[model samples]
Target: MATFIALVSALLVSSVYSAKALSSNYYDHTCPQAESMVSRTVKKAMLSDKTVPAALLRMHFHDCFIRVTPFCLAFLLGCDASVLLNSTSKNQAEKDGPPNISLHAFYVIDIAKEEIEASCPGVVSCADILAFAARDAVSLSGGPTWDVPKGRLDGRISKANDTLQLPFPTFNISQLQQSFAQRGLSLDDLVALSEFAASLQSVCPMHNKVKNAGANMDTTPVAFDNGYFELLLQGKSLFSSDQALLTNPKTKALVSKYACSQEEFEKAFVKAMIRMSSITGGEEIRRHCRVVR
Candidate 1:
């Protein structure tokens, strides 16, 4: 009985030590130190206000519309070249530049992260990197400061089906509410999530010019601001998706609030943005976040 007890004790000690060693490695490999180094370089590029990298815009193209509910990761962006090359006519390809929808937003977030990964070498979670990048993008567009929580795990799958879940440029506010609801999010979540609009640059023109209006979402078209809501107040929103805020009485009240003050939107946007970030790794963010220590 003493021999048996001694053997068990040795195994337990060994197991604990092994776990400690593995955790240390993961902690360092996914540490902010490495990511911060890369973030610093990215900041230099921004502080100088240099022309942004095309790669940064390209990161979001592949996973724009993925939802938090039925997880899918369908390839939605960055297929322009292939689509064009395979097109039957020159005009046909030019009319459409390989679209899976405008992933311009996601691309910017990914680019910032790529810079960090290059500097740190597997030390930061892309999920955390993306969260920070989003905050940066919003700041670049003139949004408020929000701290990004670190230590999120990276996910492994890169499914394309999930991409289909994101809202479309043409979706009305009703549809948007339903979409968010599908993900277990509330209508309030939709409004708050839309606050990220302040950080966006003009949206890519939809293939159909008639549909491209108001799709930009941001008033600055370059900086983040409450211009979107003001536009709503003026009844000048560019797309039904946006205009619906003013048109629907239930949602219209919120539009009036956003129109009345940027402060209102910012307050709501940050809280919701945090929630959206927390939904990581269903598909769009999985390959970047879900990394468990």
Candidate 2:
């Protein structure tokens, strides 16, 4: 366990420290319509599937977690679109990895990529598209929105085994702290990011065998509010990792504060999202999100 944590910590720290700078106007001249194209795609998809927002958000989180290590690190390739790659007979991609099996809404990225490629052609990167989609998902769900820093390059290598390094749902408070700390995130960031847990629980409850056995993480799952924090105060969170938030005084107080004020929660959430998503690395902009160019 110690060795595992150490390895994860190294990966997290290195990825963040080696990140490249991104800009909100990355595609202004090249693809001015990129953000709008992604927003429309995500919005259109959500009209049929309410789960699209949560799925896209989860996809972004997952995509940003695993970095292309040691070799790619030299080239600054963290948070690349490695997660978008498909598994081949010789090698399994990160998407096929055990931890990513439940990650959906990848097709949303594909559709957005197609639209952007049609207009811009080899201009915007898949990594940036994922970031835009995540931002759109939050705004469309009535959450706060921000101008996403773009200009990420897509990574060329993705190994299924690397996904195992991601934090697990059953991680204890100490482990969770180490995981976030390695990424240079504070307890406040952890609490804010925990909002994603509520979104996940709303789509899939704990131990439900029924197909589409969706349960509400809070009273207003569709509204992207701080109801999750309120529910957490009631011991209503389903994941042990989330319940662990209350174990520490600092995080517990944050949870209480967010529960009492939706504005505080939204603010913290947006700040954390931008900080988290900004951990960037990749090689080249992939022509197709699913395959490297």
Candidate 3:
């Protein structure tokens, strides 16, 4: 019994150590200027196109969701350039997938990568770039800023079928809960991410043919405020999924809590973003943001 206990303890410690490969200062030694460089690029893009904020945030969410929910490590497509891969005769990449069709801001990442490679060479990963770019996008658009951990390696494989695990725009509260849970997120995390969904609704409004799907999710459609929770309380959210949060007893409490306090929502949002950034596990730093080196 003692021998078995010791073995289990060792395994637990080993797992914890492996997960720590990613750190907020991952580039502190390798490419000290990476974050600032990515930030400059993201701000420039957002300046040229106001829609870049929504697109960049959505881009990060889709990247994390695609590989985290169902088969993250099994398929090797989290946050890597796999999602940016072009379809070929022998390979169907996630870029061509249905859930990813509306994704924007690929060029922003490309621009950042180009600049980073020019200065730092092969020191950073595309996954880390995506995270930094996403954070900068938020800060540039009046959203909360958070430190992004780095040291993620770029993944080599991408498939269109792997993206099937992404939650649909029509998911209800229960379905949304299940989808988030699959990726090791809880009900609170779902509430926090719903804030992001609300933010995107303004920028990615559906066409008039799609009925009520085109409505702005909150009063401040362009800002990253707690307007989502306030809108949920008023039962005026744009999507059925956003409205479903109010129907659930536990989620309803969370929505009310976040609505009353923007600081609480910001803390939760930062934690959730950090958790999502770690979904890729230990990976290599890719020189290129699109093709795996």
Candidate 4:
């Protein structure tokens, strides 16, 4: 386990030191209001549906993770907003994939895109919009805020099969590490981002036929905090992947640290999110987030 962590740390350092293609102020001149427009849309949506934050945050994670190519062992156009594409008569999109079937709150992105389009025309990309929306979702839910680096392009290809590449809730420690490492993410990144996994669990336990019945990610489900980690330590997490964190001493230590300090959790989460969302792919910026230009 120590050797594996060392290897991942080395890879993470190399990836971090590489030249960055995205920038926090990429839209300063072209669309100064891009971030605010997304934030406003998220805030408005949350007012009516408290689940909006978790949905958007999960959407961004799905978007980024599905872009990992197995053979290449690297992220290919990850976080390109391909997940926002809609299924057409000829083909299904990532949004309609088996794994993403439960993904909701896409309307929030559509509304934000429409508003940004009205104000800045075609200057902003849907990928950047989703990124900003995810950031806003966290901040508004009592999580920390960080400036999202923009300049991501929306991928035209969004295959339903691609989402199958995503990590599953049943993944063990080894499987989870390989999944994250394939996308250039380290164990630290995995531990920091695992908080979002709480939202991925089924609203109801398996085999329960209760309609419209569900479960909260934590006691304060609507708020983004270290509560997930705290709950995980208590063995309250619903997913096998969540419980897998405890199987490893290093990751278990991280879970404990985060549970003890919300400040540290927020700091690590922001850095992990920035790094994860920075994996870019796509060729063109679509006028509509659901369709290619």
Candidate 5:
């Protein structure tokens, strides 16, 4: 029995190392230039080797939906303060924008570090951490995993492109679909991705005022579930982008499929995300893959 337990532990450790090696290679070969504040933050969190990127994402999710920075800071420790520097109000200023950072960007690193810390300690590579976090973040927020080419190496330069390419709140489906397909995702993935609407916030009353933005998409927006779809059925979309999910037949059918029954959305969403989360990252090195480190 002890031998079996030892073997199991060994296998788990080996898996972590393998993930790190593949992800690091991905960064080197693909995203060789992945140097940016976001990258650095990912590195620092992985460096902590304690928190999980998924867990961090969970916290970012909780705080954003709850509209409490303290909740964010609680899990992140002083990192939130450091990220904000001296200006606590900076978060508020940035709050009105799309909920990308808090929902996806911020939490990916947290979970990656949590995973790495369980195995290699400081030896777990930051690039690997970021890659894992990125893929998981997409899954966490209702996006597809697709095929992420690995072997990305860290470059010396950094820029805004990687951060900018993220979807905006108001972007139309035609454009958003192209963005996902470019990343190798499909329409099914796109439809399930609306589950991210669970991360919606009602900040400042007018923040989510699509047709009726101030309203919560669900009874529990903080929880990753199908509440957002039901909101679409009510014509109470907070973002123009969300309303389109119902009005646009190409995608609306999927939304209705979920809205008609959260059970349907929950099953499809979880399965699709599992498929997406299982993707390996930093595998492909294209001109656009890495930020200008």
Candidate 6:
């Protein structure tokens, strides 16, 4: 684990990306209604279905994890709707992969995209919509909200094999750290985002046969509190990856701190998310999310 962290630190310095292209007001001039439209759509979706918050949040993570940064141009996949593309006879899309089989909440993005198209007509990109919806989802679900920098361009490619880049549910602390580090995230960012996994267990169950079967990822799974870190302290974690935090003295100390400090957790989480939102550079806005314009 020591070696892995060291390697990740080196990679972070060498692979650091410039988030110069994105801005909080990227859409203010072209489509002032974009962000509010996405927020409204997400709120409506979550209101209609309580699971929307968790699902949307998961979808964003899955998108970001594929390339470590959703808008990263180095890798083909990002927050683009490529993940939503259906599998063809010749090739499978990311959604068809076994690991992504449980990935839901595409309809929510569709709804937001459609509405935005009607209002702004080919102005907002699917990549930006994803970032916005994700932020709103977390905020509505009792989590922190961060200003998402926009102006990300959607890519045309969507491949199933690329989904494999994501960390496995069984990844150990070292593996998890390496994965996040590849995306330019630090160990503290890993700990901060760990709380988001609190609701993941119920969506992705242990037993294949009982897919829907699950207990809360923590005592207060419904709330975006420090319950996840609290559960870790008690030796109760939904995934091996979550439990692995305790095996490392540093991460374990972070878990203890976040468990007791809501303000601290929220601050770190917001910072990490802001960093994640910077993966995509300046790209064109797609008229349609699923297909690049």
TM-score of each: 0.59, 0.87, 0.84, 0.86, 0.45, 0.85
Model 3 scores a TM of 0.84
| Candidate 2 residue lDDT tens string, 139-179 | 87777899898888888888888887677889888888776
For residues 1-293, what per-residue lDDT tens digits would candidate 4 score against the true structure? 74575466447534642444898789889989888888888877766666677788889999988866634534477888999999999989999999899888899999999999998998899999999998987777667889888898888889999898899999998888878776777778999998755632333222332322223323333455688888899998878998999999989999999999988987888889998898777878889999999
For residues 1-293, what per-residue lDDT tens digits would candidate 6 score against the true structure? 65665575536533445543677888888899888889888876655456677677777777766644423445633455566556767777778877789877788888888989888887888878888988998887668888898877766666778888888879998888777776777778888887876754453232332222223322333456777788889988878988888888889989999999999999988988876666553346676555545
Q: Is candidate 5 or candidate 6 better by TM-score?
A: 6
Every model: Cα RMSD to truth: 13.9, 4.6, 6.7, 4.6, 16.3, 4.9
The runs of at least 3 residues in candidate 5 whose Cα sits more than 4 Å from the true structure, single-residue gaps closed, are 1-158, 199-224, 274-293
Error of 3 at 157 (Å): 1.3
How does each model score on lDDT? 0.45, 0.79, 0.72, 0.80, 0.40, 0.72
lDDT of 6 at 224: 64
Decoy 1 TM-score against native: 0.59
- Could you tell me which 10 consecutive residues in candidate 1 have the lowest summed lDDT? 77-86
Q: Summing lDDT over every window of 10 consecutive residues in candidate 3, give the lowest-scoring window.
A: 206-215
Residue 69 of model 1, lDDT score: 32
What candidate 4 gets wrong by more than 4 Å, as runs, is 1-20, 73-75, 199-221
Tens digits of per-residue lDDT, candidate 5, 1-293, equal 53343345334433432443333243444334332333445434433322223434333222212211121222111101111111132222222233434422344444444444444333333333344444444343333433333332322222222224345668787665654443334556767755653432422122322232323422312234566777777887777777756656768888878767766766676554433332222222122211211
Clash pairs detected, candidate 2: 77-281, 77-282, 78-281
List residue ranges in candidate 2 displaced over 4 A: 1-19, 68-76, 203-221
The total of clashing pairs for model 3 equals: 2
